[model samples]
Target chain A: MEIDYSNIRVIGFDADDTLWVNETYFREAEEKVGMLLSHFETPNKIDQELFRMEIKNLPTYGYGIKGFVLSMVELSIELSNGTVSNKIISEILRIGKDMIDKPVQLLDGVEEVLISLSKDYKLILATKGDLLDQERKLEKSGLNQYFHHIEVLSEKQEANYQKLLNHLDINPTEFLMIGNSLKSDILPLINIGAKAIHVPFHTTWQHEKVERNATNGLNYKTVKSLREILNFFKQN
Target chain B: MEIDYSNIRVIGFDADDTLWVNETYFREAEEKVGMLLSHFETPNKIDQELFRMEIKNLPTYGYGIKGFVLSMVELSIELSNGTVSNKIISEILRIGKDMIDKPVQLLDGVEEVLISLSKDYKLILATKGDLLDQERKLEKSGLNQYFHHIEVLSEKQEANYQKLLNHLDINPTEFLMIGNSLKSDILPLINIGAKAIHVPFHTTWQHEKVERNATNGLNYKTVKSLREILNFFKQN
Candidate 1:
């Protein structure tokens, strides 16, 4: 798919998998949690239970370590037939805590693409995560220098995108959102009349996935890698 | 400071430092970038150069990677005597791209306090960031469950807060804004006739920083920690 990049003044990127390999790390931690849970419950059942807790707690907690820890606690109790030990709970908490310290690894060619795109378009790092964690990764990876502003937010929805546009003083039509998650990046950007580039990651974090059918009619283009963005810009 | 929790039917949270640490991460990264620039230019000069680029790009790109990368490239070119090496440029670009993979670490006790408050108040996560990044954090953190609605916005200005209240189908007076940034969370909430709790984070993110004093006579209280929220509830 081609897009006219000439008129586009600002390009907003969905951090995580778009510019770096965030989901894979998250998946690694999640898999570990799943393994821990499997010691007491079936993998499917553990996932179901945790998912139920997530849905139940979303309205009150929103997101982060507090919620993740609470979900583990809830899961442990359910899996252990109400006899979950404090050790098990603490172990889960420890794992949740440890995930935050994991090292960040960038996706291939992310730097070249960002630099190339930055020359022509205004760039923003629009990412979400625990503020400290996101900051640490940026600091460690040495990527924090490029963005003029780094937005660490709570969720990605239509309102968030609108707010970003307002803050940047840009129109949705002039903005381009690039990211991996269809649910968070593509859907929200498209809904707000902003252009979006969908870069599909091989392993999606559990929470970033959405029903594919919901992405209908969103003016989003797909790419397999970051370098494709240049081609997208050239063709458009 | 004291507030009546019983009268508060809805409690909103500011995403950045209020619930988690954000600015310190950026500061760290910025400092690192400054250090990198210092290898060729004076620290003050580097700061000035980067700040100028940031100010210029923010209005065009908003917040995130696009603006950041541009700033780095511009700085490199300026520092390199108008001749930027591909290697140095790539390094800068790498730093910009690496920001997405950062881990998410929640502020201490944020979850526990929010969980306790959720039982009594209709909780909402009112934060502004990159849409996709915020949602991913929310999902991963397991906090998405607590918020009946999650608002990821671009700015937390007065109008934005007002819009949030309107969207939630609630009155401003019935809501309380709890956050770290006095500018975005406190002032806006108070402007709309709502109560605000300012829980100052030790490190404030640059963008959300008030950069000024409160002008309006807002009904607000300042707290040092999230646990104080319980006290606010008891008093009111």
Candidate 2:
């Protein structure tokens, strides 16, 4: 069955890995955390525990560098039986600050694609990251002009996308989503009867990794690069 | 000169402390932190230092219970000379979770005012707190039905208000803002040539305090409670 692009009046681009370097920094931060806690546990063990801690606190902290850092601090204290040195906790805080301060690194063809598509369709940034951090990155990325709306969601479930569409005053068929995370940006839209395009990033967070069968029969495009998306929207 | 709200077509309400009891919880949390860190500093001294630390970290953390918790943790480490017990840190983490889990306590006459105004004008929640936290509170408050939109802003400055008006596609004169903070909800709207009504909350955060001279010549009205504003909007 041929999928349709003619109905998509608005396109929501996920900010983090889809537009620029995000998960990479998180990966680096995790590695640094692993090193920081190596005295108590193995690097692999530390990584697993940190993931567990974040998931445990997801309802309380939602998603962001601050939450991630807090989880790391908590994990350090837990792993060391409430005796983790304050130096390690301080370093974790520094790691989070550094992540927030990191330069916005736009991915290949992001600007070009946005420029081309934004001329025809309304472009919005819909991400579940912290609002300030995402807004700061958007301003720093120098691509703020390309967007019409910026939505920072607490979660990107089917209901959230529905609320977003209603807020936008658009139908599901008239909206399309694009991002690297299958769990967050793609499947949720597809489930909600909207369109989605998957542009896989090199590194995926453990929580975002989905089983192969989850997308087995879902109808969406998988482009290797963002630039390739232009071909689908080019009117004949 | 009498202020005219006859031109108002949309109403924006500040969430924290405006619709519900917010700052009171923050104050209580501060007292808890002071008690927790009493060994390191006097209660007054700890309060002062924590405020200083929060101001220093505001740019990084923005606003919310999560940021508040993070600041408490950082302050603990700082005040103890990196010798704070992990138990205290864990307790701080518990404090954050409890804050997030706190029930939404609506201010007197909030629902009555919302019900009356929402019938005549489009209503929106314009807040600077965490998006998740604000959304959760709104859901719990049972006042979500009265709002047409929920906007969690990074900051409620003049430019942000200007952007909001633009987004709402309404002229400044056609919008009215009602809230508890002079620095945030009241002054910014007045500066942008929009209508604003100040309903002062019992407790205001130190950072949100405005100098008397700042509002010396401003023309916004000040109401003693949320319910009083209904009198201004009722048809003659």
Candidate 3:
């Protein structure tokens, strides 16, 4: 479909993966975590167990590297039956720290797209993660200059999008969200009558991946890269 | 000191230890952590080391129990030189889990105070911590209805307060912040010329405690309890 965002006065961008490197780091960290626990379980089992732990710890740890670290600790003890070395635990913590400290490598042409969009649309960062971590990444990304508002939402369900748009005094018809996760960035906006474009990242976290049913009825466009998104804007 | 709050149009409440039980849990957990690590270091030394670790990890872990747990894990490995048993590590993880699961027990008269103040002044939750965790506590506290806006600041500094007030379209002269920590809640607001009331929580985090020099030149009220603050307001 030929998408038109001409009516949109506000454009919301997802911070992680879409604009900068995020999920890829999480993927690499999971590999390191698997290797750290290699003695207790197979690499595949460790990966499976880590996901379970992440889902279990969500209520307490919520989402982010902090939660991920905590889950790895929990899973290490479970997998090792309390035999995992303290040094290995420290290594896991280091993995999380390294992830948090990773440079905010923006996606290809992300800044150019944002720079172009900012002139015509009020841009906002709509993301969910550790508040300080997200702020640090945004600051490091040097892309904060392009955004009028920054939101670290807890989740991206339909109600959240509706509330966010309404809170900003934006009508659904005139709001557009460009992001990487269909679960987090695209489907929710489409469900709320707001326009959204899915700019798929190289790697998506398992939690954010959804089936076709979710996107079947959703009206949104998907672009290969952030650079392609500029073509959707009427101003450009 | 006799204080006047008649000029205050919006009253901000600090979350965590102020409205509900927070620091006390940390203290109890510290005691448990010390016992768990008693072989590695003296309880007194363990407590001191934990505080230092917390301060060190603030940049990565930020605040709240999740960071505290990570620091405890790091401290465990340090105290044991990587020989700390995985069972003890699991115990430390449990310490953190218990904290996050604790009920939001509002301080005596916190609800009544909020109820009374919400009638006349616009109430806002001004807090610093993990954003999602704070929101969860706020949701569990059942205090969401009282707030006109909720802010989970990354840090409580003069610049942050200035930015927050300006963004909310609030003037410093008309704003009042009531909380337990003088550093996080009182001084920052006072530095920006905002009215403030400090209702001391018994167990203050060492990081949140400041020397009397911090209070020397500052002009703000100190109340024995949250309930007493109602006397300062004309409504009650």
Candidate 4:
């Protein structure tokens, strides 16, 4: 699918997976917890049990250290036959806390692509995560300078996308949503009559990935990587 | 600050941290990647290197896995002096893939609060994230049942909140934004004369935490948990 970048005045980008290393860190931590859980229960069971607790706690606690800490505590308690040790809880907390303090990494060709795109498109950083963590990552990553606007949101609902379009004073048809998650990035944009480019990342967070129906080809297109975006513009 | 739940004709929620365990997983994954980098250089040096890469990549990649995978590969190459092994790359990929598979965990009291609130207010799930991920999480977490309208968005700018109020056919003052992030959930709502109850989460993602001042006292109030919302409504 070809896109006319000239017509696209504002281009919005998803921050966590699109711009830098995000899910890998979470994956590694889950694996660590999974490994520990294996000592008591099967991996599948451990995941199921932990997931139940996570879902139950999400409304009140939310993502990040608080959520992770709660999950670990619950998992430890469950695995230890309701006898969670302080040592185990402490270790998990330490590991969880240590996770966010890690370094931010950029994807391949990100700079080249952003630089190339920014020359024409009004670049915006649209990401959904904890407010402070996302900003720190951006500041630390040094990517904060390139964006004309930075939006750190809670979830990527249609209203949020529409709000972004409204704030930019651009028509939905004139905006393009670019990111990896079909659930958060592409679908909402498509629903709102905006153009969307789905650059599929190899690893999607379990909750983020969606089953796609290739039959409906309307406002959305999926590309393999960021480099494909340039070609999309050139072709259109 | 107190609020009257009985007067709340409509209630909206912020997803991600508000509804589930999101950041901790990302944080954990980041820590692991950082540790891996430390094997090649000092923690601080690795952090600086990764930060530079992340900043450079934001415009090209938006958020989630694509950015993360690219960052990991870049980090591996940099740390390995451009001779990063396939094994290490595979390791990174493995970690990234694991994150996508982790189940969606909702926060504690989410169901209870939503169930109670849904009884009185026109419940809407106003969240921002990757569309597919948020939807799947809602479906799997079994919380989608409570919400009459579910909006997945890219960002929660003021316009989006206003649009939501318009869509719901409710006065801005009649709407309530309940969630963890003060930046996205509270500030935007407050900007438009809507009431917001901030349920502070321990680990706020970098991007979602915005700087608030004394001037932000008009339409916003911070609470410790979701359960306290009932009391807020009664007092007001």
Candidate 5:
């Protein structure tokens, strides 16, 4: 089934990993946490525990470096049986601040794709994370000019995209979303009758990883890189 | 100079204290933190340090309970000279979770005013906080029906409001903003040439405090309660 490109008036790009190097930082932070708590558990166990902590606290803390740091702190205490040193906890805080301060590293050809698309479509950044953190990254990425505005979603479920289309005063058929996460950016949009293109990031968060069966019959395109998206709109 | 609100076409309400009990919870959390760290410093000193810590980290953490909790954890480690117990850190995390899980408490006459005004004007929630947190509160408050949608700003300054108006495609004269803080909700809107009404909350965060002269000549109304707003909009 060939998806029509003529109907999409607005295009939404996901920020983390899709536009910039994000999940890589999280992986680095997780490795740092594992090293910091080596006395309590092995690196693999620590990784498993940290993932559990994040999922457990997702409802209360949501997503972002701050919440991720909080989960690491909680996991540290639990894994160490309430004996985790204050120094280790302090180091975790530093790790979060460092992540927030890290320079915005745009993924390859992100700017080119955005510049090419912005001329023909109203481009928006539809992402799920801490609003300020994402805004700061956008400002630093120097791609703010190409976007109509940023839409920070709490979650990227089907209902969220529906509401976004409704808010933007565009129909689902008139919208297209491109992102790295199939769970967050692609499947939901496809389910909602909107077009989606997957630009797979080298690293994806464990929570964002979806099963192959989930994408089985979906009518969205998956490209090896974001730059390839330009090919689809060339003759428009 | 009698400011004319006859041209107002859209209204923005600040969610925190204007529609619900927000600052009060922060204050309570502060008191709890003071108790947790009493052994390390006097209550007065602990309060001062926490305020200083939050202000210093504001640029990195922005505004929200997750950041607040992170700040509290850092302060505990600082006050204890790196010996703060893991148990105390765990307790502070609990305080933050409790704050987030708190039920939305609407201020007096909030629903009545929303019900009356939502009929005649396009209403929106203009606020600064975690996006997920604010959306969750609106969902819990049952006042979601009154708002066309929620606008979460990273900061509620003159420039932010201007951007908001521009995005909504409404002129300053066509917009009215109602809220509790003179700094965030009132002055910024007025500075942007939008009509504003002040509804004072009993407790304002120290960071939100402004000098008397800042509001000396601003042409905006100050109401004692959210209910009083209904009177001003009756003619419309």
Candidate 6:
């Protein structure tokens, strides 16, 4: 897809895996959880069951590490028939705590790109998840100085992007969104008449993975990393 | 403290406990948690320990039912010396889940007050805590129609209030905040030169309770209930 950067004014960036290491930690947590529940079921079966539980509980739990931890705990009881040992349950919790404590490790060239872009465009952090967790990560990221505003959305969808654009008094054609997930970060913005650039994260969650249909008319560019975005704007 | 509503252009409300039942649920959940841990320690001791754990975990959990549940789970292990049974743990989880599923019971005259004030003045729902939970409650409460804007703040300090007012482009003197917490809803706005009205909730969370010192000169009003706020504007 051909992309133009001349009209773009406010640039929005997705925080999670797009900005720093996020889904990798979730995968690590799941691996640890599968091992902990190995006594009750095979690791492969546990992974499948956990994925099923997460999909079922998304409406109730929403997204983020807190919800992920709750699903793991609930799955333990269901798998063990309410007979899971306290030691294993505690271990599961320990895994969650460790994930939360993990530092916000920014990906390669994130800061330099943000710095270069902020001079020319208004940058806003638009990400979905638990409010407190996201706020904490943003603070710890020490990249708050670059962005003009931070919007922690409940979910990223077509209506959500439209609402944000309307609230910000932004023209969709003049706005650009960069993120990892096509289902969340790309398709919705494209549907709303905004331009989106997909910066694929190394580890994508199963839920976020989507099959692109040939019939869809969404126009977007998939870059290897954030550093490559600088190539799109000569001034940057 | 004397309050003059004559110049007010917008009236802001604190959602939890002020417009609806919130702190009461926390109290109820705490009681259930203390009971579940009674076998491990004295109920009084368990209550004290839980409070300690909650305060300690506030930085990590922030303020929400999800954080409260995680604290309960953590405290259970400490109180029972890791001997807490899965049955009791599951019970604790159920207590938290029930709190989330509970109905949004708006306090007396909340809707009427909103409807009345919204006509004469722009009404805004300015509350703090979990963003998703707050959004859900607002949707379920049928109160969203009356609010010009609903802000779910992470914290309600003077700076946050200032930023909100600036975002809405309202003068401090032309705004009035009515809510149940002196620390969160009232004092901060007063400090920022905004008019405030304190409507005390029947149950105040310990974290929100603050001693009123007679030193500060900021003026505000304390209404008995939401219904009385209508009386502030004589034309209503």
Which one wins on DockQ? Answer: 5
Q: Is the docking of candidate 4 incorrect, acceptable, medium or high quality?
A: incorrect
lDDT of 4 by residue, A1-236 (tens): 44555668888998878888787887777777777656778888876777687777554344544345445555665676744443444455556656767888988778888888888888999987654567668878887667876776556889878867775789988898889888888888888888888877778876776666732665667777788788877665
lDDT of 5 at A233: 93
Pick the winner on lDDT between candidates 2 and 4. 2
Q: Chain A vs. true chain A, TM-score per candidate?
A: 0.90, 0.97, 0.96, 0.91, 0.98, 0.96
lDDT at A52, model 6: 97
In model 6 chain B, the worst 10-residue window by lDDT is B211-220
Q: TM-score of model 3, chain A?
A: 0.96
lDDT of 2 by residue, B1-236 (tens): 78888889999999899999999999999999899999999999999999998999999889988888889999999999989999999999888888889999999999999999988899999999788889999999999899999998999999999999999999999999999999999998998899999999988998999999999989999999999998888742
Model 2: pairs clashing at backbone N, Cα or C within 3 Å = none
User: How well does candidate 5 match the true structure in TM-score terms?
Assistant: 0.99
lDDT of 6: 0.87
Candidate 6 chain A: worst 10 consecutive residues by lDDT? A210-219
Q: Can you write out model 1's per-residue Cα lDDT over A81-186, one digit (the tens) per residue?
A: 6555444444555565566566677888888887887777778888765454565567777876666656766678899789778767888889888888888888
In model 6, the fraction of reference contacts reproduced equals 0.42
Instruction: List the candidate numbers ranked by DockQ, top first.
Output: 5, 2, 3, 6, 1, 4
- How many angstroms is residue B126 displaced in model 5 relative to the true structure, after the best TM-score fit? 0.4
Evaluation by lDDT, superior candidate among 1 and 5: 5
What would the per-residue lDDT of candidate 6 be over residues B1-236, giving only the tens digit for each residue?
Answer: 33567888988999998989998899889998888888888988988888899999887777888878888998998889988888888898888878888899999999888877788789899988888889889989999889887787888999889988888888999989999999999898888899888899888887888876831665777888989877768742
**Judged by DockQ relative to the true structure, which candidate is superior, 3 or 4?**
3
Measured against the true two-chain complex, the DockQ scores of the candidates, in the order shown, are 0.04, 0.84, 0.80, 0.03, 0.92, 0.61
Q: What ranges in model 6 sit over 4 Å off? A: B214-216
lDDT of 2 by residue, A13-72 (tens): 999999999999999999999998899999888888989999998888889998898899
Error of 3 at B58 (Å): 1.2
In terms of lDDT, the poorest run of 10 residues in model 1 chain B is B58-67
Candidates sorted on lDDT, descending: 5, 2, 3, 6, 4, 1
Query: Between which residue pairs do clashes occur in model 3?
Result: none
Over the stretch A116-138, how does candidate 6's per-residue lDDT look in tens digits? 99998999999999888887899
Worst 10 residues of 1 chain A by lDDT: A58-67
Off by over 4 Å in 3: A1-4, B1-6
